[model samples]
Target: MATSVSVAGFHKPLYSTTFHGGWGTSICGDNSTVLIKSVPEAVRVVKPVRFLPVMKNINEGKGLFAPVVVLARNIIGKKRFNQLRGKAIALHSQVITEFCKSIGADAKQRQGLIRLAKKNGERLGFLA
Candidate 1:
């Protein structure tokens, strides 16, 4: 006989267990393969989980004063931080472009984000 177990957030039963008095129980979860295959390709892409705000701040001319900027300077040293800060727009564009690339975003999507960053930076009185 097969026994089913339900888990929260999953539409179907997660797995099944078969019982045999002498052998105890055998567990199997054939649905895992199905679940893995069901995931969308876009969901598999890798992207930065943090630092988006930092990118935005830098683009808005808050380079040296941004908390993340201060943290990064502390972590990477002032010399390297200054190098990136000297070319804020380039650094911002590069960071956003890299994020887009990591997430497998198409060229149009990448360009749109870069443009938005530039617009926001300009509106905030920052040069980009």
Candidate 2:
């Protein structure tokens, strides 16, 4: 007698079992081994924001060119760049939130940071 068993579309099996009986039942082919691996928590990887380049330029005494560069960026409509900038902004908010939590910021102080982030986000075109 010939028997074949396979699990399709499964990359890894969490558990496997083999039964040996008095009737000569045995694993015919490569034995399936169950591997227990510790899956690390999903990490939020914030990519570098494209706006950093422009910000760096402005910080390096080229502030006068900001408006022109921003206008050009707006006209170009770089969706991916904008998305990255949005992610950067969200990461910034997360950092702020963590800082507040660590320092035990009061309700009033937390609210102040929230308002400041929102206002700066708007001014920097990070928020709609």
Residues 20-53, model 1: lDDT tens digits: 3211122224445445566697896478676454
User: lDDT (0-100) at residue 6 of candidate 1?
Assistant: 46
- Candidate 2 regions exceeding 4 Å error are 1-76, 106-108, 121-128
lDDT at 37, model 2: 19
What's the true lDDT of residue 48 in model 2?
Answer: 64
Candidate 2 per-residue lDDT over residues 33-112, each given as its tens digit: 21111223354335864654433222322344446546655776768657766788778878888889999997789779
Error of 1 at 94 (Å): 0.8
**lDDT of each prediction vs. the true structure?**
0.61, 0.55
Model 1 off-target regions past 4 Å? 1-86
Evaluate residue 30 in candidate 1 and report its C-alpha lDDT on the 0 to 100 scale: 40
Candidate 2 C-alpha RMSD relative to the actual structure: 17.0
Worst 10 residues of 2 by lDDT: 31-40
- Candidate 2 clashes between residue pairs 3 or more apart in a chain or in different chains: none
Say which candidate scores most in TM-score.
2
Inter-residue clash pairs, candidate 1: none
